[model samples]
Target chain A: AQSVTQPDIHITVSEGASLELRCNYSYGATPYLFWYVQSPGQGLQLLLKYFSGDTLVQGIKGFEAEFKRSQSSFNLRKPSVHWSDAAEYFCAVGVWGGSQGNLIFGKGTKLSVKP
Target chain B: DVKVTQSSRYLVKRTGEKVFLECVQDMDHENMFWYRQDPGLGLRLIYFSYDVKMKEKGDIPEGYSVSREKKERFSLILESASTNQTSMYLCASSLNLVQGETQYFGPGTRLLVL
Candidate 1:
């Protein structure tokens, strides 16, 4: 069984400041990771995903995540945070095989951006 | 753009009543999934279907059942609605796992059990 852990429950950042959200996963094989964001009263949107190849994957809204196999982490980062970036972020892991190879998500980290 | 549509945006159902949540995708995705979102719990998968008439239980599938009669539509059924089931239900569609496609989510249906 695979699981994801997001260390931060909530993070507050000022506008134009840099942001980083930590995510770690526990899996046996090469893991497939993803980041998703959700606004209030809305569904989730995929921020980015990492399957293989490049260690760094770029996503929508100027967000990027680096997959580190040694650390078992895929942390989301943005150089400058915007007010619109304030939302709940989730980290997920998916297995490659099986019929119901759906994603297992973290508890989520609420991001607050202050202007 | 791929669109996954849920039948209702907000639903209020009485306890012990049977509840049905419908989801449809236009992208011809082979995989459809049902998930629930709580306050702190991110998203818990209830059920999923890889193809028509084929359904599989996810991590938390005790209180929920699903039906996929057609390729594009997946329905989540709650045999008897409970207060604990009062949460946001989301539907997602994706290509098969071998394709490594990302799941596209619906707008979500918020269910309140009274």
Candidate 2:
């Protein structure tokens, strides 16, 4: 079965430090990938997506993710972290097909930025 | 900008009561979906519709049902609300596969059943 995994359940880093959240997926074929962020008491917002073409995709809030087919990974990264950036991030894989297009989401990784 | 709106941001209901959660999107998307979100489980699809009046079961659809009488509206119904059904319900909309669907989510309704 196709599934997504976010190994890190939670990560804490000092403000202004670099951040990376790992995501791995298991699928039979090349799949559509996405990153989303959800702040406390809020819905998820799309951070970036990888459908085709350029392996590196940039998304809102100065976020970027690179899709590596060989590694079966799409990791999200940011150069510097902000206190406001503390939120839960999710990695999802699209079940790309005809009319049954839906997403398989990872458990989620919660980031907490320290002062 | 695409806007998805849920009827209630927070709801409290008694157990065994029938519950209705309404969602509407203004983007005129061809597909709409209802999902339940828990603390550690991320999001699980309860149901989805590719077109008006067309519905399909999703990963966890045992305690829920859906309706899509129009293109932009999708409603999630809890047959008889249970304590275990307390969750954040999210609604999303997207285009068809031909258009390369990317879901847009609503603000979400946090339903609390007691």
Candidate 3:
């Protein structure tokens, strides 16, 4: 069985400040990773994904995530966060070569951007 | 743009009542999924269908049933709704396994059972 762990339940950062959300996963084989964001009363939107290749993968909305196999982690980061970036972020792990398998997701981290 | 739509945004029902939630995808995706979301529990898959008329039980599919007669439409059914089933239900669709399995989600249906 695979599982995802997001250590931070909530994070607050000032506008224009760097942000990092931690995510760790337990999987046996090469892992497929993804980041998703959801605003209040809205469906989740994909932020980024990592199958294989470069450790650092860029995503939509000026967000990026780095996959560290040694640490069993895929951390989402942004050099600077805008006020609009405040939302709930989730890290998910896909099973079976990213095939038609269920995704295991973290509890999610709520991000708040301070002015 | 890929679009996934759910039948309802909010639903209130009584315990032991039968419930049906519909999901449709306009992108012709072959894979559809149903998930329940709670405050502390992010998303737990209830059921998924890789092809029309073929369904698979997910991690938490105890009281849920699903139908996918058409490729674009998937339905999740509760035999008898309970208080524990009160949660936000999300629908998602994705391309076939050959394509990267990045799912696009619907707005979600918030179901409350009294």
Candidate 4:
């Protein structure tokens, strides 16, 4: 069984500060990882995904994630946090070639940015 | 850009009432899915369809059913709405297993069963 864990339930960061949200996954083989963001009262938006390639992948809204196989982690990072960047973040792991190909997601981390 | 739209953004239903939630995607993707999101529970798959008239149970399929009469539309049905079913329902679509791996999501329908 595949699962995702987001260690931080909530993270508060000041504007212009660096942000890092932690994520870890448990899978048997190579996994497809993804990060998604959801604003209040809205659906989720794909931030970035990693199939297979360089460890570091860039995504929309100046977000990036690094896949560390050794650590079983795919951590999302931002050099600077903006007030508007406050949202709920989720880490998901995809089952490769599964018939339905559904994603298993973490509990999510709520980000709060202070002005 | 691919667009997935849900039938309603907010819905209120009474206990034991039958409820229908519809989702449509313009991307012509072959796979459509239904999921429920709750606080601290994340997204749990309810049902999925790989083709028209075909449906498969996901992790959490109890108290729910689905219909995929067309490739572009998927409908989730609650046989008897219960308070426990009150949550945000999301719809998603993606290409076939090989070509389209990323699932595009709709704005979601918030269902409240009283």
Give the number of the best model, judged by TM-score: 4
Going through the candidates in order, their DockQ values are 0.60, 0.55, 0.57, 0.54
Give the Å error, residue A24, model 2: 0.2
TM-score of each predicted structure versus truth = 0.96, 0.96, 0.95, 0.97
RMSD of each: 1.3, 1.3, 1.7, 1.3
Q: Candidate 1's residue-wise lDDT over B1-114, tens digit each?
A: 999999999999999999999999999999999999998888998988999999888879998899999999999999999999999999999987553568999999999999
Better of 1 and 4 by DockQ: 1
Please list the C-alpha lDDT of all candidates, in the order they appear.
0.92, 0.91, 0.93, 0.92
Worst 10 contiguous positions by lDDT, candidate 1 chain A: A94-103
The DockQ of predicted model 3 stands at 0.57
lDDT of 1 by residue, A1-115 (tens): 6789999999999999999999999999878899999988889999999999999999999999999999999999999999999999999988755544668899999999999
Model 3 stretches with alpha carbons more than 4 Å out: A97-100, B98-100
Local error of candidate 1 at residue B71 (angstroms): 0.7
Give the Å shift of residue A106 in candidate 4: 0.8
lDDT of 2 by residue, A1-115 (tens): 8899999999999999999999999988769999999998888889999999999999999999999999999999999999999999999998765546678899999999999
Q: Considering only chain B, report the TM-score of model 4.
A: 0.97
Task: In model 1, state the lDDT of residue B100.
Answer: 50
CAPRI-style class, candidate 3: medium
When only the first chain is scored, the TM-scores of the models are 0.96, 0.96, 0.95, 0.96
